[model samples]
Target: MLLINCPFCGAREEHEFHYGGQAHITRPADPEQVDDKAWADYLYYRKNTLGLQAERWQHSFGCGQWFNALRCSQTHQFKAVYKMGDDAPEGLQ
Candidate 1:
């Protein structure tokens, strides 16, 4: 089983956390101005990179704060964990 470190509650089982998908993706200010293609891209598309992915995770069983994690997709290893609004470290971005 993989262990995920919750920034608010320390480490815990991976099942306790919920994957919130890719982080740092922002929505357009004007919904009407956004084209269908752009909306679809924002809603359905993802980078899906292999190594060193920056993603948003929620500590569902812990302090319940949404945080960012640098995780390896292949081995499910976490490199670093940080709260929202904080810098993503040098390598993660």
Candidate 2:
């Protein structure tokens, strides 16, 4: 099983954390002025990258805190972990 290291609580089983999809998604500044296509893209489109990817995760069973991680999608190996609101190491956040 995959093991995820929580930024706040250290390493733990994967089940303890919840995958929150791709991270660093910037919402439009003016939502009301956004067209249907833009809004749809914002809601449905995702990077879905195969290599190093930034994702949001919550330590549901531990501190219940949220954070971001850079993990390899192909190998499930994490490269970095940082807490929410913290500046991303690679400027991805």
Candidate with the greatest TM-score versus the true structure: 2
Q: What lDDT tens digits, residue by residue, belong to model 2 across residues 31-73?
A: 9999999999899999988888888999988999889899889
lDDT of 1 by residue, 3-85 (tens): 89898788899889999999778787887899999999888999999888889999987778899998889888899999887
Best by lDDT: 1
Clashes of 1: 0
Q: What would the TM-score be for candidate 2 when compared with the true structure?
A: 0.88
Clashing pairs in 1: none
How far is 57's C-alpha from truth in model 2 (Å)?
0.5
Instruction: Please give the clash total of every predicted structure, in order.
Output: 0, 0
